[model samples]
Target: MNDTGRQSRHLGIHIDRTVGEVYAYASDPANLPAWAHGLGGSMERVGDRWVAESSPMGRIEVAFVPRNELGVLDHHVTLPSGETVHNPVRVIADGAGSEVVFTVRRQPGTSDADFERDASAVAADLARLKEVLEFD
Candidate 1:
């Protein structure tokens, strides 16, 4: 009911790692299943693309932004239903560590509770990323 929480939300985590380091690990499509639980499966390379049989979305194709030092990890996911979602993600240096950010778009007509859950999932994903990188 509030305009502020109406359509989109940004969520992230701070990892105790350099921006380039975090960007390098997270930007690799092969690492998705390790941190992104919703996409839990070994994603294989198909030519220039990555395909995964996601836990919830069935088979999907993902395309990540070309590797860069600036920490951009944007990607697109094409679902079995033919719907494509652009995920805006980034890793930024914060003092000696880095911050990873993810944008969750609340699909039109999404309930507030559903949006909140989506944001929570993103936070958990980021936490997993932090755990994986910090423990290494």
Candidate 2:
């Protein structure tokens, strides 16, 4: 792909829970800290957005889409440098349980190392989500 072209990697995990259960829990920004360690361990609502003050990338503002029945939990994270990253996430039924998928896109000018790092982080986050939803 060209340097300016976007590349995405999908990281996912299977959680031993119903789609409704996973959707309800994952769709809430307040519950992010419990499993989304990549986004920080704490968050607070400020007006219409959720702010994470101690994220690995520093402070960031997160805005999630409105709740719906389609199991879409997409959100945008505004970095400290004012760049907003769109994170596409979904929950889908898999047999009696559910699967969660997170799409990580390589931004323009991102190096191969950084892109792989982002993929690793997403994998860890998905694993954490499964652990939280299944064992917690």
Candidate 3:
């Protein structure tokens, strides 16, 4: 939660593994295209930052702090009216498993319907990730 009343939707699961092992798999940029649906391009390192291109989301920039066990991904998508919506994803490790939180703050004059749609997409992505990591 933040001052803007924009709270993230947090998802969590516990795995029978060490935090480091789970973190390694989750933080690997190369694994994104395998589990993440819309990511089409490879993740490359630009100095200390990571960037990936997606067909649906365009270019996304990510920053990670391994010591703090935090990651942030920032991206934008255009609406039907040509308005851009910002989507931020925050990833953190709680214990054996990790917690993934997604936040979407609507642009000025944007409707809540758009936010709901984006949130559903995020949920789907997370669900896919869980299936890949846990079952596969």
* Best-performing candidate as measured by TM-score: 2
- Score candidate 1 by TM-score against the native: 0.90
Q: Quick one: how many clashes does candidate 3 have?
A: 0
In candidate 2 the C-alpha lDDT for residue 12 amounts to: 80
Residue pairs with colliding backbones in model 1 are none
Q: What is the TM-score of each candidate against the true structure?
A: 0.90, 0.96, 0.60
Candidate 3 is scored at a TM of: 0.60
TM-score head-to-head 2 vs 3, winner:
2
Q: What digit string (tens of lDDT, one per residue) describes model 2 on residues 42-86?
A: 999999899999999999999999998989999999999999999
Candidate 1 per-residue lDDT, tens place, 1-136, comes to: 6554347778878899999889888998899999998775789999888998765779988999899877889999888889888889989988999999899987666787888888898889999999999996
TM-score of 2: 0.96
How well does candidate 2 score on lDDT at residue 113? 93
In order of TM-score, best first, we have 2, 1, 3
Which sections of candidate 1 miss by over 4 Å? 1-6
Clashes of each: 0, 0, 0
